[model samples]
Structures are given as C-alpha cells and as structure tokens.
Target: MGLFTDAYDLFCIPPIMRLIGRVYYGDVDDPKKRYQVPIAITSAMVAIALLGAVIGQLVFGHLGDRMGRRRVLAWCGNWRDYPLSATIMSEFANRRTRGGFIAAVFSMQGFGILASSTVTMAICAIFDAASHSSYEKTPKDADWAWRLILLIGSIPAGLTFYWRMKMPETARYTALVEHNVLQAVNDVRNVLDLPLRNEELPPYPSPLDYPFFSRAFFRRHGRDLFSSAISWFLVDVVFYSTTLVLSQLNDQYLPKKENMNAYQDAYNVARFQALLAICSTIPGYFATVLFIDHIGRVKIQIMGFFFMAIALFAMGIPYFSYWYDHSDRGFLFLYGFTFFFSNFGPNTTTFIVPAELFPARFRSTCHGISGAFGKIGAIVGSIGFYWASQQNEENDHSNAKRITAGLVILGGACIVGVIMTRLFTHETMGRSLDDNENDHVA
Candidate 1:
C-alpha cells in the first residue's frame, strides 16, 4: 500500500510536468529551443523532489535504525517510502520466499503507475471534451487539470496512513535490533496469527552501541554496501530519467503548433504514459515479482542491465531513420523491452537487495544510503538527458544527434551497472537477513 502510493505520486510527475511546462513555459514558437526546461532551473523544479528523497532517505534511514523500523516506517506522502517500505517488507518476509515477497510488495509501484496514468488519461479525456465547450484550450485551463491529478495522488496516501500504523513491528527487528525476545515472539505470533514459544535473546554486541558508518561497519559490510549504493544510483539514473523524459519528448509525435492545442498536447502525453504503463512497465514488474526468487536477484539484475544497454543502442544507432519513418512501432517495441527488463531486473533487485543485505539494525539506514545514491544518479540523468535531447537545434541532424546521444550515454550507464552487480552483489534468493549480514563479515 505504501509502495502503491509512492508509485502513484512518483509517476504522476511525467504527465503533470507536461501540463506544468505548458502552463509556466508556455508554447515556444521555436521548436529549436535550447532546452525543454530552463537548464539552470530544471534541477530545482523537476529534480528537487529527488534531492528531497536523498535527504529523506538519510534522515529516515538513520531514524529507522535508531528508533526501530516500526516507528520510522513511512506510510504516506513521504518520499522516504522508498527505503522505509523496503525495510519493513524485508524484515517481515522469511527466507523461503523473501525475494519474491519483497518484489511483490514493490510491484505495487506498477499498479500505482497504472492508477496514475489511468486517472490522468480519464481526466485528460474530460478536459479535452470540455475544451470544445469552453473554448478554453490554453495553458491557464491545463493548470487546474494537473493540480487535480496531484490532489488525486494524495488521496490514497491519506487513506492508508491509519491502517499502515496498525501493522505490528516485525519479529526480526524486535529480536535482532531491540534484543527483546519475548516481544519479538509476541509480534511474530500476532503478525502470523499463530502461537509461538517465546525464546531467549542471544548474547551479542548491541547494535545500539555501534554506529553504522563506523570502522566496524567498514570491516563487515562496506563492500556490499558500496555495491548496493552504486547499483541503485545507476539504475535510477536510467529508470527515472527514462520515464520522466519519455513524455517530455512527445513533441516529435505531436502535430505542429498550428494544429495542436495545450489540451491536445496534454491528452497525447497522458495517453502515451498510460499505454507505456499498461502494456510494458506493469508487465515488467509482475515478471520480477514472479521470478526474482527463482532466477536469483543478482543474475536477474546483471541480465537486465545488459539487455537494457542493448536495447538503448538498438534504438539510438538508427535515430534518423526511426524519426523520419515514424519508427514508433518498432521503437516502442525496443523501448518496451528496456522497460520490461528494467523492472524484471535491477530496478526490483536494487530495492530488494539492500533491504536484505544489512542486519535489521542497519537495514533502513543502509537502504536509505543506497537509495539516496540512486537519486543522485536520477538527478544527473534527468538534467543530462534533457540537455542531450536538445543539441544542435537548428541543424538537420539535431533531433537525431540528441536522441542518439542520450541513449548511448544511458546504455553505457547500464553496462557499468552490470559490472557492479557482478562484483558486489551476493545471491540472496533463499538466505535470511541474518545470513546475509554474516556473509559480509571477514
């Protein structure tokens, strides 16, 4: 449920951004404009939320560790939901089905995307219809439509907050982090709705006495942590940037300004986003939910990254022909593959692995640190891709140059992800979190 809301809020940005850009930036007569967003301001407006995510990941991660997962679990509009949800779900999931379960939980993101696109599409249809009656097809009218989309995104988060709090703390966190055997046992019993014999706490160094970024952590889990952070950073740089910019680039497919209204542009973007989510992105997520455990997270991630790189190259190299011939059908097929393997690959594993690798004591904190790194990648990719998409505006090859360059760069990023996964990630298909923590030890 938390992830569902996060997905809804996170993805609504693409179409909403189109609407916002139309309102604030207005229609530019020069299709050759240097940038879709003011280059200086893009990071502040479009990427600011990611900056908030980095802060939220660190703050909430540390708080989850210090305060315990139950207290720091984010249920609503908090961007920290990225790490917090993963931590909570990882702790609750047992080894037998851990990967599949966590992926399943994370798959709510696909549904959330589905919901956001569907809702936005419905609203766009309404607005497109109403525009004929009102003769108000300008930027001013589009403002309220996008605002309403954001308001709808907030509603689910509000509804789930009270119920999310009702869930009991995970037994692993109680036993491992808090060192409260009886309470842990009770939590497990309540959560499972079954009886369990209370067990005694094992003697070990209290995680409360240790700091996460200390030398002790370096010796134990540093390499794995580095891997998680880098992989997530690479994945999001590609993932978020891809999703965010896809709609932004719709001007190519849109009719020329003389034939297009703000309503038509919005409707096209909404429709594009909806189709991508419904046909490709959601299927990718469910594939991961079904297969992460069977394939192993590391293998899936490595394969996902490799294939994504290939697809990007396939689309990028033929840029001029694709554009002139209206290669959307074939382009979308390759584009859809990239989306598919992404969810079926690193996108899901990156989120799942970090949650499982660290002990409950450091689970959220480490997850946050990893996720924050990913957002940095997101920031870089968002700004860089937009700039790459705008090169040589007046030249005959300008569009081709930008499209080819963005894909080449993003594809290379995925290749780097493949190397990182191979070196740093351990197979955790059926391993317990306790098992993972010890594996990283010398």
Candidate 2:
C-alpha cells in the first residue's frame, strides 16, 4: 500500500499543481491575485484530507487492532495500490544496492512531473503570448497540447494495474495479527529463505482483547503520534512557505522583462520551478540514501532542519531589507536551498518513520494521522504566505516583514522538531520488530 500510494501520488502531482495554479491564478499575469486563489484551494483541500485522515486513523487504526494486519492492509490497498509498479522495480536488487534503486524510483517521480509540468506550462505560455492575429489557432492548439500532456502523464498510473492485481500481503502482517505462530514463522522463513521452528515463533498479543485505548497502548504509542505530528507540521509549514514565497520571489524580483505576455511569463516561471524541483529532489534523495544510515535519523533530521533555518534566515535578510541594495538573487539562493534540503532533509524520514515505527495494526492510521497534521501545516503555510504577500502588496509594506515572519516561524518549528525527535523516537535501525518498544513481534 505504501509503495502504491507513493507512486500514484507522484504521477498525480502535475495535474494537482496545474489545477492549483488554475484556481490560484486564473491568469498568472496578475501577481496580487496569483497565489491567493491557489493557496486558498490548497488550504481547503488539505483541510479536508487532514480531517478525513485523522478520523480514518482513529477508526481504521482501532480496527487494525481488532482485525488482522494483513486484512487491514489489504483493505487500505483500495487507496494504496498506486505504487506497486515502481516498488516491484525496486524490490529485485540486493540489499546493498536497494536503497539507491528505491531512491531512484522516488527521484524519478519528481522528474516525471517536472517533464509533464514543463510541457503543460509551455503550452500555456505559447497560448498566452499568441497575438490577436494568431487568435483563431490559439485555443484549439493549446487545448490539444494540454490534452496530450494529460494523456501522457496518465500512462504511469496505468502502468501499475498489472502489479496491483498480483502483489501479496506482507507475511509479517499476517503472522502478527492472526496469532497463528506457526504460519507466521513459515511466512518469515519463506521471505528470509531460512528454516523455521515452532519454538522460534514469536509470542502474540491477545487479539481477543483489543488494546487501542488502554493505558499501556497509549503510553507506548501516544508519544509517537505527538512527535510525528509535530515534526510533520514543522516540515510542511517551512517547506511550503519557503517554496511558495520563493516562486513568487522569482517573478517579482527577477521578472524576465524581456517577456511581456502574462501567460508566457507564468509558463516560464512554472517551467523554471518544475526544473528546479527535479534538480533538487533527485540529489536530495541520494544525499538521504548516503547519509541517513551513517548519520542516523536523529542527526540527519536535526542537521537538515537547522541548515534550512540558516538558509531561510539568509533569504529573509534580503527580503526584509526591502531588497535594499541588491536584486532577488539572494532570495533565489534561499529558495534553492529550501528545495534542496526539503527532499534531503526530515521530509523523507518524516513520512518513512511513521510507517516503520508503529505496529502493523496501526501503521496506516498513524501514517495517516501524522500525514494529516502535515497537511494542516501545509494549509497554514499556504494561507499564511498568501495573507502575508497580499498584505505586503496592499499596504506597500516591505516584503521583508512577511518573509522574516515566515522564516522565523519555520526556524522555531524546526528547532521544536529536532527536540521531539531526539526525546521521543527510539533508534530503529537494524532493530527487529520484537526489539522495538511495545514489542509487537508476536
């Protein structure tokens, strides 16, 4: 389900961004109205997704405890079946090279969208720039191009169909939930290619008595949820805030005055952003693969967030200074760092950790719960950026003030994330499920 969800969402991105841009700026030529609409819709959609995810986490999470993990995961696959094709591609390699391969899959998702968005936005640019003399051909040609891009982009999602039909449920999930110690043992043996003994089977929790609300369960899981939620919140807030501000900054300060058509300008800006995202995200994943194990998740998260804080501040200085003596180059550097570190930073772990840490019964719920908070943070960041930008534009105040506020808030949130991760999350590297806290190995 995790694999499927990741892949499906990746392909859906270009359309999502296109829809967002449409809502945010019906016509990108107008800066004042540009971000407001898109951010507003973004806020709404995220709010809804967050709400549904939280309730789903609570309900489905509890159900996972009552039902078997395998059953619950299978059910979740209804929404989770999008990434199998990519996951299968990653699964064949040996362990040493697997991370690189899987990271490539993750990275390719960005590249796919970058390519799609680039072409889509290019069409928009061409249409927007067309003269009245070209008016008769403009609409038809632009529509054809957009339809073609959509058709091509949809291919990746279609590719997952075959794999989705054949993938088996995780054997570990079956073992833990069904309490069939012998079957569980055999399942693990099959995957690991080792012999199994009944004596070696793990002890199972009492499925008859669901323990979701019990003090023991809360004691073990509550702190994790809080920590995951807060960390996700911080990541989303800072990440989206910086990304959006930087996008707007590009056009505002670095206006390609040579290009005067509004649609053309927006298309170029979007294409530029798509390229930047691909460039930064691919490298970021490699950095994660290389350093995540070596530095440890705790250190990687802290370093990533802190580095982002520094970059945010660096960008904010000039923003707050009213571009006092320089151009938007300083701001662009900050934006670039934000994009780079985002994929390279806690963003990766934040998503992966929630899935890895929790018990199988609650994995999706916890992931969804934490993911919900992340969405809230994304909404806040989007709305906040729009509000600040609007205020700055309306009152003729220095863009610096809003940029400073955004950066300061993000820095503080990063500091909080570092603290939560250090205090709450246990070291999971190479640790068996039986060894982790709550001891659900059985």
Q: Which structure among the candidates has the greatest TM-score?
A: 1
Tell me how candidate 1 scores on lDDT. Answer: 0.77
Residue 90, model 2: Cα distance from true site in angstroms: 13
Pairs that clash in candidate 1: 233-374
Q: Write the per-residue lDDT of candidate 2 for residues 1-442, one digit (tens) a residue.
A: 2443343333333333543444334446766554234555555664564455445544554454456444444444322321222223222334344444444545554565466556667566556556443222223343344455456544545554454434444554565555566666666677678887878865755442345567766777788878778888889888766654445555565444333333444455556656666667557766877765556656677777878877766666555565534674655666777767776777766655565566655555566667667757866775677567645455445655766676667777777777777887655444434344246433
lDDT of 1 by residue, 1-442 (tens): 7778778887777667666666776656665452144555665776787888888888888888778776777432456866778888888777888888888888888888889878888887788777774344354568799889889887778777876678787777777777787888788778878767764433333344457758877777798799999999999999977876654555656554335556665566667767887788889888888888788999999999999999988877776656545736777788888899899899999999999888778888889999899889888888778767655666757767777778878899999999989998877788877775455443
Candidate 1: where is the Cα deviation over 4 Å?
Answer: 25-40, 74-78, 134-136, 200-210, 254-257, 321-328, 437-442
Q: For residue 342, give model 2's deviation from the true position in Å.
A: 2.4
* Candidate 2 colliding pairs: 4-82, 4-83, 24-37, 24-38, 319-400, 320-400
Q: Can you give the lDDT of residue 35 in candidate 1?
A: 16
Over 4 Å off in model 2, which ranges?
A: 1-109, 112-115, 118-153, 180-210, 253-263, 322-325, 437-442
lDDT of each: 0.77, 0.56
